[model samples]
Target: MQQDTIEQRPDAAADWPDQIYDLLKLHNIRQVALVPDAGHSRLIKRCIADNTMKVVTLTTEEEGVAMMAGAWLGGDRSVLLMQSSGVGNCINMLTLSSIHRTPMPMIVTMRGDFGEFNPAQIAMGNATQAVLEAMGTLVKRADTPEDVAPTVDATLRMAFNTFRPTATLLGQRLLGAKTFGKD
Candidate 1:
């Protein structure tokens, strides 16, 4: 696919989560585990609503990781969707990612940056990138809606090809405050 072939303004097509679905479809990712966030609620809902993709809602981020790992071992491509704060919660399970050599891609919606007014999200938001990096993730930050599809596509391709985990930081700058928009 051409790198510049993406819509700039938000539409049904510019919906970040839908872009996720398109990328997964392109990658043949038949199953996925999701730890829903307001940031990803629409996308997760879309995944669950769509019959083409198998969606597993997880209680915690670690559960998502474990489930995706199992799917990968069974010869299916999978993705984990979660907010940045969940990264702190899933540290232990993250070790399994490296130990098993699971090359799944994680799409993380960053909080506590840019327009963030939440004091609670500060720790995880600040530490989010560092934590994932420490855990050996090849990270990329998408600062615009148009950037999301290609970044995710590239990250998934890189992770699968290298057999290493990859993370795409869905930065606050790109998404702004609200999760859903019709722009």
Candidate 2:
């Protein structure tokens, strides 16, 4: 199969995705929850193929939130991956982490902010950061190949240390805008 725009991004060659996967292992995160998004393809594949990790493919982003809650309750470290558009779906569910102080770590691949082709995607992507902040999520961003490891490592430390809901947004600048086939 051919790679998509996200996979062909220069950062992919730099292997920020691998750095993220390594950090996940370093943190001993045993569970990976996500819905399919091209920006996360490599990392998702890595987590799925790793026997030490249990990857949960969720139908919606909110389900990952609930599942992470359960995973933490069961004494396993977990993280969620989704696109900027999906953040809207988890608005209410994020309360689970905020009110209870659960360690919910999320990696969101941003869209609609840079070279976005789909006008529909621009709104949520534009609002994701502010909305997540309003909902009490500690949001960080990784906008370059060099930003991946440091941002993710720091977000993980923050989330696990204080049980705060944290997210590291893989910005459009980092993953490149999904320009599929437009001019």
Candidate 3:
């Protein structure tokens, strides 16, 4: 497996997801568990393309929590990719990682903020960060394209290197606010 280093360039910020993929490769994160999400489409596609990573599609978000825990016990690094709405599903399962001191890193693409069109996405999305923090997971916010790479890098370090459960919330503003309808 080839490890790619993220270059510090002005245009690098535009490709934050790619930078994150590179960091994951650089750190040898071999397991990826996720609930399919449009917010994470690009990163998910990248993970699918990489032959070195084990990508698992989950039925529910909590399953990802359990998957990461198992992967860690097997001596492999793993990350969960989900949307903010999915956070509610993992609240109880999060205790497994927290109490057991398993390092689980989650990348959550936020909704119900900024230009969100669906009123249904509001409640859970607004509570995502608070819920994760309450469950003993360190939460980091990346509201800008420029902040994405650095926040992901730091979260990965804190989660894997320090054995801390961490969550990186990717704001909707950075992901281009979703529109209501299309012609």
Candidate 4:
């Protein structure tokens, strides 16, 4: 049944971002910190529109990581959204999560992999997962739209329940890889 929904139809993927937003609500995520990216526009907008959610637009990805630490300390559940290239910026702040065994749920929109077009995205995008894992973050990916909700749900549970940092990578398949002169 789960396989049928996840693997059978790409057409059903249209609402995956909404599904992720619903999961955030379900998880009682009260704070959202993000460095905006095109791939995350939908989710970011959803959170921003919600009055119950405290949404912070960050100057850098690392600030979001540190902010989550403060949020968790204050008994508020928080999530960070960033592009894969921003992952490098968060490495040091992730130590706060690691050292304190605090939950920091982050959603990353990937670049520089699969069908990536930008030359600069290649390096950090390729290294994102490795960097997160090195910081002891439980890393996972949602390669297709259908995978988004489930992947994010699991990461949220893993982070909140286990008190560990977790990241969900939204892959190019879902966001549509950026390419030259292609709409």
Best by lDDT: 2
User: Largest TM-score belongs to which candidate?
Assistant: 2
Tens digit per residue, CA lDDT, model 3, 75-183: 9999999989899999999888877889999999887766566678889988999989999898999988889889998899999877868989988777753222210
TM-score of 1: 0.86
Rate residue 180 of model 4 by lDDT.
Answer: 30
Candidate 3: residue 160 Cα off by (Å): 1.3
**lDDT of all predictions, in order shown?**
0.77, 0.85, 0.82, 0.83
Clashing residue pairs in candidate 3 are none
| True-structure lDDT of candidate 3 | 0.82
In model 2, which runs have C-alpha deviations exceeding 4 angstroms?
1-12, 177-183
Residue 141, candidate 1: Cα error in Å is 0.3
- List the pairs of residues colliding in candidate 2: none
In candidate 4, how many Å is residue 11 off?
Answer: 11
**lDDT over C-alpha atoms for residue 24 of model 3:** 90
Clashing pairs in 1: 10-183
Q: What is the C-alpha local distance difference test score of candidate 1?
A: 0.77
Q: How many residue pairs clash (N, CA or C atoms closer than 3 angstroms) in each of the candidate models, in the order given?
A: 1, 0, 0, 0
Ranking by lDDT: 2, 4, 3, 1
| Between candidates 2 and 3, the lDDT winner | 2
Which regions of candidate 4 deviate over 4 angstroms? 1-13, 177-183
lDDT of 3 at 115: 59
